[model samples]
Target chain A: MAQRPTKETKQSSAREERPPVVREKAPALAPQRGRPTLILVGADKGGVGKTTIARVLLDYLAANNVLTRAFDTETPRGTLYRFHPDQTSVVDLTSTSDQMKIIDTLATAQVRVSVVDVRAGGLEPALQALQDTGFLDAVAEGEVGFILFHVLGSSIASLDEIAEVAPYVDDADYFLVKNHVNDTTFFEWDPVTHRKYFEKVETAGEITIPKLNELSYEQVEIAGAPFSTFVANRTAEGGPADHSFVLRGYVRTWQNRIADEFDRIRLLDRIAGREGA
Target chain B: MSRRTLVFVACSPHPRSGVSTTARLLTDFYLSRLADVEGFDTDPHAPRYHELFPDRTQVIDIAAIRGQISLFDRLLVDDGVPKIVDVWQRSYDRFFKTVKEIGFVEEAHLRGVEPIVLFHVDPSETALASAQSLSASWRDLPMVVVQNEGAAPLGAYAHETLGHYPSTRRFVIGPLDGAVAKTLEQPDVSLSRLLVAPPPEMSIVIRAALKAWIAPIFTQFHSFELRRRLEGAQFLK
Candidate 1:
């Protein structure tokens, strides 16, 4: 009505209206720079507790006030979304638009960390997608921080993944996670083969997710709550639940163990763009 | 009153320290009191506990996941039935390891299940050490020191700061007479049933002696359970 405003003027006026990004007060040990972080949790095989690892990472990031968002690759019915419904979305990582939705927003998203839970058999495809989009190039250029968590199962194929995925993580943080959520035994992996893939990469880190009790694990699944929530003995909606104290303690202690590994890797520091600090 | 399930785990690292005897008597005592009770002999291979109460007791080998679910899943359920486990020393480490891993005792407390460890105090240094070690690991777990009248006295090991824990009370189980003990040792035998109505053929003197033998033990069991109920009682102020 009042002299038709130009697009540029309106955009500038709108940008002026928005408040400045108030960076969350990181802990004294956290890095000074608060750059965006991208973490990929993937496994070539199904049921390696990839989603479980991603959920814990989200919790760890959240605990450190990292301001994290997650994309569960378990499309249609995201297992990660179920536990962390408020901060997650289900997406097809290989789809063009979906890829853009994830990769495009990292530069501008309010969240400091973005976690992508790669679906079964999607690790290579997801990596290739990142390569095609030159996302790895951006990460290498130090525009943003990136991490690839290769969730390993018990099979020989899991070892083969180290060879396939190891090449791409040269510019990003690479973690080889041996998920024992299913209590898998790696009798197939001899020390020589283990050394060939793991030892060769000086930057690569190994994390062993210890075996939790069968009943406790099953109960948590049945409760359909995040590990932290389960440990608190609360329902998904934060309602009262009659969960066992012993079971909750088991989860809490186990989560602490897993969190210790993340801490040892300086995960928060890497996400905050502090390599040596 | 919320029907609390008492899960008494009669255990020892040393063998034949009267673990099964304690378990059997406790199970029998619950049955005698007309309380709903279930028994589990952790060793399926040699399920001697279940042999006494075949219909009521189950042989559960918790080494496998399936067995663990069968036992632990039910323990958390509000069945209003107390459970007594005749734990084998051979499988003691594995059994407790799994229990501690699963957080069974804590869970049991939430579900109104009281899990008490009845450590069979015997002569071996290993047994004494394990009693101290186990009580330390399971600090929140209710413990009772069982002194088998047939076994050696714990001496310094029974001291509060050393072998025996602070909260635990002492129980003297047996120095049973040969003929009387033989009668109770028979398969499917229940001391409670015998005490209530001894067999017609059983001599009055033998019956009286059997009742007398079990008197202090049963009193200790009742008193220990009452004290625990008073301690861990969620409802009663």
Candidate 2:
């Protein structure tokens, strides 16, 4: 019993003296270097992985050195604090009046990148209200807008629902991503259905997200007293995620997919000679 | 919104009860006194005083304060003979060093500004119950005992403590109908009809009371400032 008490004290002291482990800071992205603007991530459908996709894109962008700010319209359900203090994430907690001020701040942007994250089935009404209030016209002046539609494989009906609200953002890039696909049995992306969905949208961005068979996860644990600093201890002393089995597979699959989308958009940018077009 | 000069001290966000109501009504009444005023809701982003009578109004958030305090100062100076509605109460203990009471008044004088301070004191059982859990600093600040029609005897135990501050201002608040009966019936429910307008009798008493109460503290404040500036100076040992 006496020995146990001494061991406990020793452990406690060691824990107290241990230096804090700092997360690797990614460099700021060239695309969002000078101009800090608000990004709203929105989708018009429910259970469409809007929040999850936003989190993944934010993490990937931050890891690759993209400076971004996020906003959530709802309460206690924010996405900025998902990964501990990284350079790529910013969030604005503002009311309706203040949101306008934030938009005004973005107006002078030399390079402003904003994403609107909307709840599934919440896009139609929200867009109409914003348009009625003259907020969207103000926003469209200096923003590269994208409407994300996450659908299950072979769900043309779901895609059809999204298409009904597609006219509002006819000029914006509309991306149809197939999300959380763990099984390929019942749902397959038919060329016929793909063409139909394309016909519905004025212009379709690239189809990017892969099936669940392509997705990967790592067994990472959060340390620190608050259990908030969830470090992926899969990398070298301070390097990119390692070439080890799970980490490499996860990065290669997800990161490469996002990079491919970026490349596709980059090609389009070069062809049009327009950064935001 | 057209920006207007907001002459007020800064304080934390509203607590659950009296603080919000007091701040809101005080601002509303002050704005109502002016012509062509528009009022914004209680917003965390709003500046000290939005242009209630203005061409436009915008809530000034803390970020705005950090970004452009100069703009705010300019507005203050431009609104000549501006009425400063101060809401920051005596948070004496929160400071790294203890604040002498007269230090505050002298700072205002040096700054060439005098804010119309609103010291909110509610007589309801609900308000008293809140005080029981209040911080020591909050309990120590000067308090005014207010009674509306049919209101509870809030001043019964408070008068002895408040009587010490001759500068303390009290009011017999009433509903819009000039009846305290509504306030008495709903002790827990906040009474928005209670305005911050000073009672005529209290107005007559304030100046003399303030002079007597603050006289001794003025010297203490001066001494404190002197000691602060001379801390590093070499003196006769």
Candidate 3:
């Protein structure tokens, strides 16, 4: 029989093999002089559940009594806007006027948090546009609070998107979200490769969205209501609806799991300015 | 005020723990009262409860979406009919998990229904731990610990441990002789029918034994009903 290396030994050996990376400190939760927080949710790949994450974030914020507004960059037919129509506006992020509608009114708007659901294949371009508009500069200068939830697909290519987004988020709260809503066997990246990419952004955190029952997810999609509303057995009009109790239960469980993950990361304390309180 | 609709969930994590027997007894207890009662047999493969009460019980597979909808959706309907579910060991975890996730207890209360768990006590340590876990998880929900001596007689240690759980009440099913137990196992056996009108073919000695076994259990159930109604009245006052 052979003796297995202890966790400490393995960690020390790995540290000796790899270079020590410079880690960034956490940002002040209460933004510089109460600047509103902006969260950009995006993935280079399509069908990675960007809107779903945005919707869950909106729900979490709403449950915590944080006033939030969302912008769906999918243009004329935004999926996020359909589910959260009251506070979401469908816009083309490529257009300057819509960008102004989101960025220019950040401090003036009644909403304390702004969530932007960037379209597929739009992450790099979105970051570039933000850099061109000097929003990244403002974040770097501590003039505003920024959080980028880089939703990742289960592909090596998705890891490549992290490096591209890292330089822009040096001062932002970057999170790599592994969404398992559609597929359970996700993120088959080699540990070394995964660590190498993660090391690109030292302040980056990982959040997992657990798999939800397909039927329940589809039912919520068909109902066109928020997750909380579906769990409450209410229709889009706020009246009692006849949704299946089993499906509603599954959704409620899934939402609670996501909420737990958010709470674990101190998401409300991080972005809602709750730390000061 | 009218009596609140009741939903009795007979459950155990291990097979041969007298879960089905408890469910059967509850179903018959309601039937003896002439109240409208429905039973859900979660074991679609071996639906003994449904077979016994085919007209009143529905066979449901709790693992499947369609079956879950059929069971839970129907349970939410407040038409004043009581429901009893025989949670097969294979479906027990899913059944309780779904109930907690859906917030069924609270919603059932709001709809004028009370959900009570009839946790059958087996001699196994697993059974004792599971009952304690359930009691801790749903502290507000009413639970009744059922000690079925004929199925799985509890040892002193197991008995003492289960006694500590915060159960609303304890119902003990006394052991029956082998002949009577075998006779009750028949698919067509109806306790209510036996108490109301014993068949002529049944031996007088066997009839006497069956009556002695069932009458006290029914009396306990009746007393529980009276106590519940009294509590409701006091709440109103």
Q: Best DockQ goes to which candidate?
A: 3
TM-score of each prediction: 0.77, 0.37, 0.87
TM-score of chain B of 1: 0.88
- Per-residue alpha-carbon lDDT of candidate 1 for residues B9-90, written as tens digits (9 for 90 to 100): 8898878788888888888788789878888888888888889888888888867766665677776776768888888887
Q: Per-residue lDDT tens digits of candidate 3, residues B77-174?
A: 88878899999999989988888877778778788888889988787778878888887887778899988888878866755766666674888888
For residues A160-252, could you state the per-residue lDDT of candidate 1 as single tens digits? 776666556667888889888787866535787666655655454778888787777888899998888887768999998877655666677
In what order do the candidates fall by lDDT, top score first? 3, 1, 2
**Reference-based lDDT, each prediction:** 0.78, 0.38, 0.82
- Please report, as a residue range, the 10-residue window in candidate 2 chain B with the lowest summed lDDT: B92-101
When 1 and 2 are scored with lDDT, the better candidate is 1
Provide the lDDT at A164 for model 1.
66
Residue B82 in model 2: lDDT: 37
lDDT of 1 at B185: 70
Question: After superposing candidate 1, which stretches have Cα over 4 Å from the reference?
Answer: A1-33, A43-49, A59-67, A74-86, A131-134, A153-160, A181-189, A212-256, A274-277, B1-6, B54-56, B74-82, B109-113, B151-168, B225-237
Q: Give the best candidate by lDDT.
A: 3
TM-score of chain B of each: 0.88, 0.37, 0.94
lDDT of 1 at B216: 82
Q: Which rank order by DockQ, best down to worst?
A: 3, 1, 2
Docking class of 2: incorrect
